[model samples]
Target chain A: MTTGAYPSQSTARLTRERFRAGECRPTAGIAPGMTQTNLIALPRDWAWDFLLYAQRNPQACPVLEVTDPGDWHTGLAEGADLRTDLPRYRVWRDGVLAEEINDASACWEVHPDLVTFLIGCSFTFENALLEAGIEVRHITDNTNVPMYRTHLPCHPAGRLQGEVVVSMRPLPAAHIARASTITARYPGVHGAPIHVGDPKALGIVDLDRPDFGDPVRIEPGEIPVFWACGVTPQVAVMASNVPFALTHAPGHMFITDVPDSRYHV
Target chain B: MTTGAYPSQSTARLTRERFRAGECRPTAGIAPGMTQTNLIALPRDWAWDFLLYAQRNPQACPVLEVTDPGDWHTGLAEGADLRTDLPRYRVWRDGVLAEEINDASACWEVHPDLVTFLIGCSFTFENALLEAGIEVRHITDNTNVPMYRTHLPCHPAGRLQGEVVVSMRPLPAAHIARASTITARYPGVHGAPIHVGDPKALGIVDLDRPDFGDPVRIEPGEIPVFWACGVTPQVAVMASNVPFALTHAPGHMFITDVPDSRYHV
Candidate 1:
């Protein structure tokens, strides 16, 4: 969140400083090595089914740390505060965008009952992939990873239901297997590639177009490897249209105390 | 389920037969090489919170599969009749013990009903650990694994509340690292050892005294390695005593079609 002097603030230190100061912004590359999680805050009534849906779909909706209902901060992620820790949060009420806020501390009063769900994001694995000589197209190209709505239906739990969302990476076929083996180690974060070759197999009709995030190039000889995207639970939330919901923006992530490697299975 | 000629029927074939005959029995050693899951059935009203509890406590509760409310069978596990697959069922009414039944077909009714939760057991990983020359105490002692109620509390979901239950395995120091590395792969089942040495750290007063199952010896240099157990959920069920709850008896698992190796990470 620090402008030109960003290097002066470490990822963990900076995240805390920015979040505590109420400076809300996208935290994509804010913390280089620290694990950044996806935020999905739902009403107490809807928390269980959402949790079950995530359980049913681990490859996509890997949970990092979940808080007890009515508890704002879970002790798992160091001193990170769930209510105002993230840069920004989007509020969805009845499937409609209601308000975007720097923090939800004010909103918590409406329901002492709101539950927090911090899910593992692909960003954790993508950071790992980059360090291992793999060129993450979106990061290299300075755009969000291309995410699509797949035809594959998630095994429904209770009333929460939706299609699977996948983030694609165009890497060599050889790297697909290696990537699968590497990322699969971190089941806490969305681990491993769910689909390796075909986009259409996931009901994706076009390569250049995506349902979420920006599209990147698929260089020749590079096979498109798809990993379960964090957007999965969001889609379920939208479909359910519960009276109220809150999630971090597209690139913004909730920074955690956990290191990337430790999240491995 | 058949008293005569338990042989002549392969584990796979036998699973199908018992399922067809509406026989619900403990599926501990049945179906060699295949995975067996723990079942936790709750009312539609309590489904979400419990599912969330499972998500937060996956190591103690690996959700291998789940069924929508009112649905009895988990299509993932080859026509598994949740109502009558396991040999017996423990019914809980308002967090109190209602009764233990041989079959739940008579108890089951339409809508506002059963949500089957298939949790992973340690059987699959024990097979792998054994193959690797590690000693799984209960297996050697010819009895059920020693499970103890821990002082450590789980991240609760809604009305679902409880303590963490752990299964013990005594191993030498050298095997601890290898054991940790190997078992860490099966996140769908309880992953690696949550505790390597100190039992008191988990609020366990006496190693000889356990809340469930029998205790085994910790030879000189042989130490206890604990993995979160599925019994953790039952503790919550016992604490809440939600009316009309069902779960597999301790060690009596619900056999599944999925292979054990498939669950690695």
Candidate 2:
């Protein structure tokens, strides 16, 4: 999912251009310096609920940009068409996955009043973690990060309500603090780890079995750290049985022109 | 508007209790350690525009908490009724001031689907400034902080559109940086000064005659520092000619049970 090339701004544009030209791939490493976001497009009627939900649970759903209803442009990415710029998209009908596609133009035609939200993805902080000398287990293994559903309830907003879903990365006990301090600088991304050292604490029984993405190797001296994942809004959409929705496929995020440093506090 | 005597958590609760019983006074000094907020309630249909407007112009309209439609309870204050707890309220009808009153319960009866938004106020950070030994001019003068509607345009969201509004404070040139650094820690509370030194830069011709609140003396060797003010949203509501709205009367803000330190980043 990561190229580790650390593309420049122009390169970031080129990556999105390629995606617009029908190339599909995970966006983590392609634009390391630029920001990558989790995409969620909800109907105009459901927009308020999702926006309020994100506002309430900022740690899990830090909104980078929310497009006006029926608008596909975001200020974060210049000259980028959100409908076509993402490498892959998932269209949902009545809370269930309808189909996975490379372009969402057809979905917009069916639901023109969709309001798109570009939420901060934790992948934005992975470069900082790696630079701080901490191993992001999923990136190190060249695989999608492990994620789990938890019992933690997010503050309900209007029609949207669901439990928090968290992504896991096993860090050596010594590097845990450094990893936290590094990621905490970017609250626009998922800030620091929510819990560390116990899977039971988050109500997970097995380390190897993840609800989404592939499981990674957890070394003996490593502690499992959990972060509020961007997938939370999708979980909420599903739980609420939203009539129609669209989201970026897991690990295949929307790469923006905004530099990761812009979100740094 | 400031009391200088920083109160504890219990005093904060007592203060709200008094307001709930119809005590009408500015909330500054009554709960110095607790958070203060700017209240704006709009009909459910207009809620999306205002929420998106706040999200886009965070510096001027930092949202603390937003209530569900027709709901008056805020999680920021436990058991505090939004309709009755505040000292005063301004009822707006078709973008004009319809009336000013001590309680908004009657107004809610007419507009049952109003969604209330609690916004961050600069008063929440004034205590921190004073504790750091920086003299806050408005607090020193016992006046409402002077606010101005700037020529700077806010990023429009849906139907809401207006310019940035700023609160000004004159500080000794040496203390300007310290004041900025101090307030920058509380992003939820308007964060830092948007401008310094020149009032002309913000299109203000006179310092003595402020558009809102009272003017403070700018001493020799002192420079005027400007911060994004909570009034920006009211300005937007007026500019957009919103059919109906409710806001706390200027200087008479809603005091929350949450500590001022809780907003510190």
Candidate 3:
């Protein structure tokens, strides 16, 4: 199920209930003031390694909440069921994409000891940048933010190892400092731009050709600023060939009841 | 072995080597410019719960580094051995204090899969406070900072649950805001004071008698300011009756090669 637009007035709980009822859509605009989280679930054995990986690479994988083994409930959202709450779920088997479905309840039967991780999403800070009168090109163009895999390797933890993946947003050179100051307040999300000007510095060859998401236009005086992407954890899962895993489909995030302000320092 | 005073000109490596060679003394004044960490080690099975506990109660237990299971190495201090690079350690069995030792190497044989966590200490921020021209009473008096076991229960994570423990410093009312703003910059360490005045609000009965450490004088116009303390995780271990655990003895912290400025925002 897909909706052209979700009601902006809807609360996070109501929005999650809609997703649970199979209303599949990206959660960016829904529950505007609430926090949206990226979800990943791994079996108990691999959970420790993944958690350590997140700890080591916090810029790319700022953790919001981690649920207990076999538990689907998260403290971030009251009365929400992780098994069927999100708009869509990706099921991975031995590191390869096995299936993309609207409901993940059946997948839990195969691996009952799955531990869920809710990670901070950049959408929270994008709101702050917009409030500070900084233009977010991807939001203006109504396209997914361009993300690329970089040569910069993430700190290895336990059995997990992967290179960094970053999301790019073109901003006017004048607004770069203001954008950095605003986003730095939200470290729970990917905080501040890692690289402000050159794409080659991060080993990216072209801004037009992104490994993930849609590319947006770069204005005459604008520079491409890159922030560590949440997808870096997904890359680690794939590169490490995790035996079994589940994650929210790209853009189809889990809207938590917690407000965006809670993450603001 | 005990020394009257460690030379202030020494580097963290030299200080750690001295501690490793059995120099029994408090670490606060030993490593003048480097970071000193509170250490805790737990068996593999209990590590997850304790990590979750710290995540849930970050104010009281800000985590600096977590070592891999059965790994004695920490990224915070290169070439520092977790088993012997501390002035002292406390070995606990079934939640009871079993032995206090200068070396933890012998105890590791029993729980070989132990995971070590290096936690942020108040001493890091206390230095900042002093630099900001705020008086640190305990340091001036040459006494341990007064700590109280509060009725404020930490948000429970997994099987680990405990009350919040706070370190009190009597400061002039005017310095409270500046102190908060200063410490808030160092989120890696315990960021800001949780309570500024009225000990009774935290269920703390008396200002003169603290549960741990020595009492300090509260001047006429000065008020008691309580910040979350590093002793919290140890309190959790005691409250949860953890089967096997090892922690640095109070004040006998593990000096790390990392500079305290690295913890400053």
- Give the number of the best model, judged by TM-score: 2
Superposition error at B53 for model 1 (Å)? 2.7
Q: Which parts of model 3 are misplaced by more than 4 Å?
A: A1-10, B1-10, B29-33
All candidates' chain B TM-scores are 0.87, 0.94, 0.91
Give the per-residue lDDT digits (tens) of candidate 1, residues B147-175.
Answer: 89998998777787899999888899999
Instruction: Rank by lDDT, highest first.
Output: 2, 3, 1
lDDT agreement with native, every candidate: 0.76, 0.86, 0.83
What TM-score would every model get versus the actual structure?
A: 0.84, 0.94, 0.92
Please give the distance, in angstroms, between residue B201's alpha carbon in candidate 1 and its true position after superposition: 4.2
Model 2, residue B218: displacement in angstroms? Answer: 2.0
TM-score leaderboard ranking: 2, 3, 1
lDDT of 1 at B17: 60
Q: Each model's DockQ? A: 0.52, 0.50, 0.45
Q: Predictions ranked by DockQ, top down?
A: 1, 2, 3
Clashes of each: 17, 2, 0
Q: List the residue pairs that clash in candidate 3.
A: none
- Model 2, docking class: medium
Assess the local accuracy of residue A164 in candidate 1 as a C-alpha lDDT between 0 and 100: 89
TM-score of model 2 vs. true structure: 0.94
